[model samples]
Target: MWKRGVVIPGARMQRALEHPGTRRFSLTLLAGSDAAMRVQDEILLARLYNELVVAGRIHKTTRRNRFKGLDRIIVEVLGRELPDVPEIALHDVGASSGVTTLELWKTLLSVRPGRAHASDYYANMLLVRCEGHPLVVACDEEGAPLQFTLGEFVFSAGQRESLFRPCNRWLQARARARLPDVARVIAARKEGRTLPSGWSVEVVALWHPACRLAAAADARFTLGRHDVCAVMSPRWHFVRAMNVLNPGYFSPERQREAVRALAGSLLPGGLLLIGRTREEADSSNVATLFRASSAGLEAILDLRGGAENKELVLEAGKRS
Candidate 1:
């Protein structure tokens, strides 16, 4: 049976960071280095976020410029539909890592200025202090740790040299087998019971520094944790949900519930954008822009092709 690598002491890692010679060496082991955390480097940020996604086994995945062409068209429609509106309140549901949310916000600014709120089901990162060994964890909306892994960072001397190696099928299988222990550790922490030496865990926010900076620097951009299936108060003038409501991810009933919630969140006459992108090199998008009304959602624009589940959206709208 494969075993988890021994955990290196957090005190030792801290000491390594304090020294000039070892600082660079220590930084190499971290998922997010000090410089990478402080700066807004898109490529570096995406890589760091992807690491968490893989380790946590979270299904939410997104990429930069994934909706490039579609976003411009959506903005154009907004300009024409809500012409006299000075400012639009926009909300992007299931905005993983929020990199693309910023992209859409910048595009919206070209035509009109608005406040943009980016939300996701798993929006928070947990910095788990395990005994003296530090582990970074990603959490669900309820603040429970999604998953944990020894492979997330260089937690032991054995991992230091092999850290950069690709995790093959065998390694992934072993990681999956070890999840029970990860859960045990989390439970012990939550119950306030004493953990075995080197196994004790403490959790805290490790929110990406770039996300914090973006929200602070721009009054218009904000981030939050939200589940798409949950009902929300009507507030936003425009809501965008991309690559989230999929037939593969949710049952038809659940999709209808999510659509109802999304529709209910829109202000009267507000617009709702729903779509998916093909994984082809061109990243072609199939989407529909809907005008929310008391009667139901009226499809105003179809890009490339209408949304794959456009009928489900319309059906949900009718019942809403």
Candidate 2:
């Protein structure tokens, strides 16, 4: 996850930096809904799970899974592709809050703890998340989220009418005011004091999750504030750019450059996986796998979400 203050070399777009002609290769963009968006509808919440907070007056927006297609063909592919090496290094691009990132690591480690033929290859993995601007965290003075309590309910005893006005009105009109209402928020702290009412929300300092995670100082995992456009690291075995690449966030040329940067960060014959997803439970996503070669990155597979897609959608690289 990318932090606000930490400086990561090459994380920014250095227009002065240029890719040599030899390194620049051609790539064909896959059409249709074949890859996923970085699918995390629920980001790091401002407050802890137990804290009482909501997304201001309006409800929060969640559109996709934190990680796309984790339980589907992806795992199968990983099991088959990942060598039984002693340690596997993965670069999870655009890892927000590290929920899906950490979960994926745990699943990978736990799935085959003692493979009969698998090597003891298990070690630290890298997660990179960064954007051009700063991340806004709604944490209180004491470090808890004040603006948006991540996991807390939105409704309170006082604001029940506003949040659930429709339902309440329906019940009154029908003369059968039944059916339990929305979950109410619990009392929470505000600026080091207990909030008397759940609706007493306020704007506290922005508390980005990257800051908290960075401070933890975990050795098993290292955080890098990296920009996908200019990743500054040695090549790796695998790189997953989940839900970050699209014409919407960046232009076509910049999109190509982003792919180039991610591909450059891979070792020869390394695997570069790109995906974007929407809708949490559907798990239906689009994924593209490319291989880094002397000729540049070549698409090897196009997964259109769900468990059905297993065959490789091989695409020939376009060379200028």
Candidate 3:
């Protein structure tokens, strides 16, 4: 579902739908490629690096390759479960536009059976006064809800702004990184060489913290370290595979204790599939969380493609 040039819903749209408090909204598909078209204010950059698939800039199968990695992690998780799971809830933290969600559903449903839910904080639901009172509406253009309002969930613009800030900031930073290159590409358009498209740019712009936090909240509340933290970058996307930098602990001091906690929570033969960066300094507080949840190391994959900046994949499992 998330091939390189395919236009999917942007993160903002995903937020509007996944947020529990939202109610009504409508959409009409645009012409041309999805990445080539979008609202002016909501421009999205795709994550892949391709001059053109048909023109032979690079292998057209890059998109499929990324999804293959995602499938590997999913299969690994299922393989380690005691007797095969009838349903599995995949938590894609920092899910932007639910692209990963669509891909996961397509893959897992074909083989294993289960539910896949992607999450992002609700952004479009707004609270306002009508005539002389307060009301809530599911809206997009800041004017009004098209035809409906639903439920009793109350929300304020301030809350929406707060929840949306982190992801917005992340995108803004990527846009900044991309602007100069885009300008040059566009300036050279006299020969018909132009930049990929708004959405195409975004796919590459996605980085670790920004993209992950965008979908982070989607996972259910209960997570145990040994539970096999399956993570994938999906091909053409910037991330390689998810990694747990220090396994269960990021620092020397907490390493052993964190490993213990992770081991205690995991069922026998449980696993962790992580996505991380090859960049030397890439680290985070998640070490505390993973350390408390994971068991001893099992297998690890260095999925980096010799790219200067890329994420890595790390796996840990509870011994039987």
Candidate 4:
């Protein structure tokens, strides 16, 4: 019997398992299997990620090897422009699960040594224990809470106080009834005691095969939270923002702000790669590469006809 809110290994899981290529990324599986345990962690992480996306309505999806063609171009550009720079610094924004980030990191390292930083607005999930009861909270890049979870019950930042909202009342009531300590957990959180007595909260990253592989001792790689819209000191030699600056995700004004902020975070003559991949069988990568300069971003290369919203980049450059 499946527990409430537990994702069952249905057709999708079976299909992935049958085909070895996607089994590790499957979100549904038998609860006791090793792959299932890993997938359970992923599901929890996804729930937390989804909470932030739903609240902010941001388009921050990612996948492994999504930048196969684009990464080759990036490496080629770096090798040509800064061939002698022994250590290049690269930042991957909105690096969901860090899969593609790691992929790009390894690809770049193969050609030249560099430090890779993977960042996302929603990066870590906190599992808090209060008197043996477990509660999970989704935290932003700053460690601020965005959503809370008790057992199968997940609620947004302020939804706890307004559990009677017409759309969520029934589900909220049922979860509350099953896990009465949810009230205690909330009360404790209000008092800043997320854990009782000697218990400590555990922080877990979104599980991915690539993330696990990167966990090994490597001074060249780091992971953290960052909101691209915020001002940041210029540091990186290369910055990649894939599937993040989409017109569907942000308003024209917000996209302009993000573009400027990203452009501002580049060293003189640094490169900014922004684009998205199609969902077709080929997963064609359509993006634009810009070189940052004193004046503004100068388009240097376009892959598969450039980014779908290259006008936004141009508009931002005009105003910058």
Candidate 3: tens digits of C-alpha lDDT, residues 120-166: 22111222212322122222222222111112122221122134456
Please estimate how well model 2 matches the true structure, expressed as its whole-model Cα lDDT: 0.38
lDDT of 1 by residue, 72-104 (tens): 887888888888888989999888777678888
What 10-residue stretch in candidate 3 is worst by lDDT? 51-60
Candidate 4, 315: how far from true, in Å? Answer: 2.6
| Ten-residue stretch with the least lDDT total in model 2 | 22-31
Best by TM-score: 1
User: RMSD in angstroms, all models?
Assistant: 7.3, 19.7, 18.9, 6.6
| Candidate 4: regions farther than 4 A off | 1-56, 127-169, 176-202, 207-209, 212-216, 280-282, 318-320
Local accuracy of candidate 4 as per-residue lDDT tens digits, 209-281: 4565575568688887788797788998999988888777778898888989998888888899988787654
C-alpha lDDT score of every prediction, in listed order:
0.65, 0.38, 0.31, 0.65
The 10 consecutive residues of candidate 4 with the worst lDDT sum are: 22-31
Model 3, residue 296: what's the lDDT?
A: 46
Residue 143 local lDDT, model 1: 37
Better of 2 and 3 by lDDT: 2
Clashing residue pairs in all predictions, respectively, total: 1, 16, 45, 0
Could you tell me the lDDT of residue 47 within candidate 3? 23
Estimate candidate 1's alpha-carbon lDDT, on a 0 to 1 scale.
Answer: 0.65
